[model samples]
Target: MGVPLLAIVAWSGTGKTTLLQQVIPLLKARGIRTGLIKHTHHQMDIDTPGKDSYLLRKAGADQVIVASHQRWALMCETPDKPLDLADLAARMDYSALDLVLVEGFKDEPVAKIALWRRGVKGEVADLLDEHVIALVSDENLTIDLPLLDINQPVKIADFIENWLR
Candidate 1:
């Protein structure tokens, strides 16, 4: 079976990362092996400057695999073309994970729980999208979808677990 994927989407500074930091451990405590994918618009480089891996990449290597006993990482340079959500997910090793929690890619047609704050202006209209299965917010919204408390990670994890099942 394909791994279940869910996106935790919100506007910047709306506590998406903070919620994940709490939710992941809670999920792990319940024996759910989770994978994560974080999307960013800013230019990012995982390889350190002047490092062998960095030098290799600078030398026109399209992909670099750095390995050691503890952990390994694959850094691919995509200068011209940006990959879509499916492409990114396909690259993840899903055999050991029960779920893949995706962060960002708000427009992707995937099941998601959107975090909304009262003062923060986000894509609130996204909550109406079919892909948004649930809404997590501080205020009590009267939407037709399932509403979750923003401060309670455990409860949110419960909702996610039930959804995964």
Candidate 2:
């Protein structure tokens, strides 16, 4: 079967990463292998400066693979093209993962759980989109969608597991 994908979407400083940090371990406890994709608007470099791999990339190599006994990484320069969610997902090795959790790319047409708080600047009026399957929030609300307490990662994980099934 194809790997299940979900997005945890929220505005900046709304604890999206914090919630994922909690949820990932909970999912692992339940024997679910998870893969993650984090989208950033700013330019980023994974290679260390002055390193051979970094120098190779600096010398105009399109891609560079750095390997060690413990870990390996592939750094590709994509200056002209901007990848969307599907493009980024395709690059992942999903053979060993049960699910892929994406953070950001809120506009992508994927199933998502929105983390909402009252004071957050980007709070939505209602999460009525077809892609928005659930809501996790700090304060209880009278919304029609399925709501889970923001602090309870186990319950949230359960909700995700059920939805995936």
Best by TM-score: 1
TM-scores of the candidates in the order shown: 0.95, 0.93
Off by over 4 Å in 2: 126-128
Q: What TM-score does structure 2 among the candidates reach?
A: 0.93
For candidate 1, write residues 1-165 as lDDT tens digits: 278889999988899999999999999999999999999888899989999999999999999999999989999888788668888888788888999999988888899999999889755775557899999999988988889999989999999999999
- Cα lDDT tens digits, model 2, 57-115, are 99999989899999888888888887777877777788888899999878788999988
What lDDT would candidate 1 get against the real structure?
A: 0.90
For model 2, the local distance difference test gives 0.86
Residue range with the least summed lDDT across 10 consecutive positions in model 1: 121-130
Q: What C-alpha lDDT do the candidate models reach, one value each?
A: 0.90, 0.86
